[model samples]
Target: MTDIHPTAIVETGAAIGENVRVGPYSTVGPNVRLADNVVLESHVVVAGHTEVGAGTHIFPFASIGHKPQDLKYAGEETRLLIGKNNQIREHVTMNPGTSGGGGLTRVGDNGLFMMGSHVGHDCKVGNFAILANNATLAGHVELADHVILGGLSAVRQWTRIGTGAIVGGMTGVEFDVIPFGSVIGDRARLAGLNLIGLKRKEFPREQIHALRAAYRDLFDTEDGTLRARAEAVAETAADQPLVKMVTDFILEKDDRRFCTPRSGE
Candidate 1:
């Protein structure tokens, strides 16, 4: 019982699953596949070899699965794979992958892409993330679970944002943001833990306390490299899971500089 408006265009060979609705003037391309209970509001265009998962709702003027904006893209076959229960709002653009980027762009489940947000080619955005209005992710960026990009924030190409990080409004992130870090300023710097989010998600209070102490020890000290300080904390707070996660992320094989707290804070 898929209900598609007469004015909408479902190209031949497109796959629309049960209980889906394609609204007025929307277009589903030949290579598009909409899973069960998907809803495309008016004027949405889903193109390319895209597979939108079940229970996703896309609003008007969303341009999904378009060709990558990369100048290096020479029209090779690429794909955008979106997971379940995402809310993609008006004027959001999610481009397909490019050959140079391994030919796939992946979005995990339960994301909220607000108005005018753009996910660049080859980005891997993780589950439970929120990209606020006008937030932009450059090509090949990887966002770990529960990351939140505030309005007008942007990340440079190839940067990896760790789990539970928050990039504040108008910030430009040029480095890797640590998990649970709150970053701000035009050129981003880590401010502190995202305490609100961590509390809302019900992270263990004792572990949060340990992470705060470790944050002060790791970043506040001028004595050691970040990895070295994190290693020390890992040894001391080794029983704390959050501390271990922070240390592991610090020691992981990442190319970008780790975001550090401002000198005073």
Candidate 2:
């Protein structure tokens, strides 16, 4: 029940599901698995222990599930897991995890990875994330759902971007970004809330209003500590899921510094 081109090479032990379409000159390695309705355009290379979930479409020349590009990597078996309904565009490169940083690079559902984007080793990309053209995430970065990385943006290793945050084009993120935060500039700094994104997602007006108020109290006001402010806001906005997400992100224990607003803002 699959449509595979004669030029395509489906290696032995590869598991391809019903309604899958393999195009010209593509290669599916022995350890690869493609679920139902998956489409691999011409010249795609899916190697290693990679699994393409159902309803995903991969464009031409993507090299996925390849060996990690770490000098310390020593042939340890690792895996790349892509979720359903993802649109992986041309020339994107996603590497598996390295032994030093766990053994799996996982991407969640409904992601849009544009041309030339790269997900480095051991990254965990959440659902509904968007990586614009040439966006790059260094090893061990974590992107929460609804996060958007603008074209040419690069995130440093060990950084985490919380849900609904957006990093502007050409920015370099060296620290963790808060939920719903919008940032721009070469060395990215917090730039208020992602108002447009919140609106587009149709978040309830009351929730949005509460989030805005919380943002001000957490960042604008001189608080005892970020965690303390987050907890206070969480207590007040107990019914708001978005508020909890923001507080939870703030409370996450990580070595990386938190991204803050520029001076004189």
Candidate 3:
């Protein structure tokens, strides 16, 4: 029961499931597999060794599964794996991985890629994440579950954005962003805990309070020794979920760099 526009080109080797729709002038290349209920709007292009899960909708002019733009790609076999129920808006471009970086770019279920967004090679995007309009993630970036990248925000290569973190509009993130924290500005200062986001996600009030206190102790001091403060806070606030999130984020090392509080602490 799939519908394919006359002008659209689907390679014979492609595997398209039931109820899928391919709009005008779209193209599905060989080795591409789209599960049931997926929709590819006008001018969409899905190529390479890519697989789109069920119920994913890719809007007009979105180019997915394209070879990595990295110079080191050298025509190696790479893959782009997108999970179910994702909404990839117009003009968004997602590149597959490079052999130099594990040969895979993966996106989890229920993610939203707003218009003009670009996800570079080797990135791993988590479930329910939101990439606002024009947001750009460079190569090797990892975005955890429920993280929000505001409009026009740009994250540098190899940076890890923790779960539930929020990067405000126009921010430039060069380092790892702590879980549940709000970051803003060019160098990305730690504004505070993402209380509004946590509240919206229905996190309890007591957990929010503990996180706020932990944030204060971790970032408010002149010494700004986040590790020690985080350890102490973790020992005292162990029972709080929010506290555990903060402590784990501080302790986890991404690409050998810990999340550092903004300078001038």
RMSD of each: 1.0, 1.4, 1.7
- Over 20-91, each residue of candidate 1 has an lDDT whose tens digit, in order, gives 999999999999999999999999999999999999999999999999999999999999999999999999
Residue 14 lDDT (model 2): 99
How does candidate 2 score on lDDT?
0.93
Model 2 lDDT tens row, 1-265: 7999999999999999999999999999999999999999999999999999999999999999989888999999999999999999999999999888888999999999999999999999999999999999999999999999999999999899998999999999999999899999999999999999999999999889988888888889765977788788888888888888888888777344788888768
What is the per-residue lDDT of model 3 for residues 1-265, given as tens digits with 9 covering 90 to 100?
9999999999999999999999999999999999999999999999999999999999999999988889878999899999999999999999999987899999999999999999999999999989999999999999999999999999999998889999999989988888988888877878877888899999878878888887777777856456777788889888988788878877775234544566665
Residue 165 of model 1: what lDDT? 93
Candidates 1 and 2 compared by TM-score, better number: 1
The best-first sequence of candidates by lDDT reads 1, 2, 3
Model 2 residue 137 distance off true place after TM-score fit, in angstroms: 0.8
Candidate 1 Cα outliers beyond 4 Å, as residue runs: none
From the highest TM-score down, the ranking of the candidates is: 1, 2, 3
Q: How high is the CA lDDT of each candidate model?
A: 0.94, 0.93, 0.90
lDDT: which is higher, 1 or 3? 1
Question: Each model's TM-score?
Answer: 0.97, 0.95, 0.95
Best by lDDT: 1
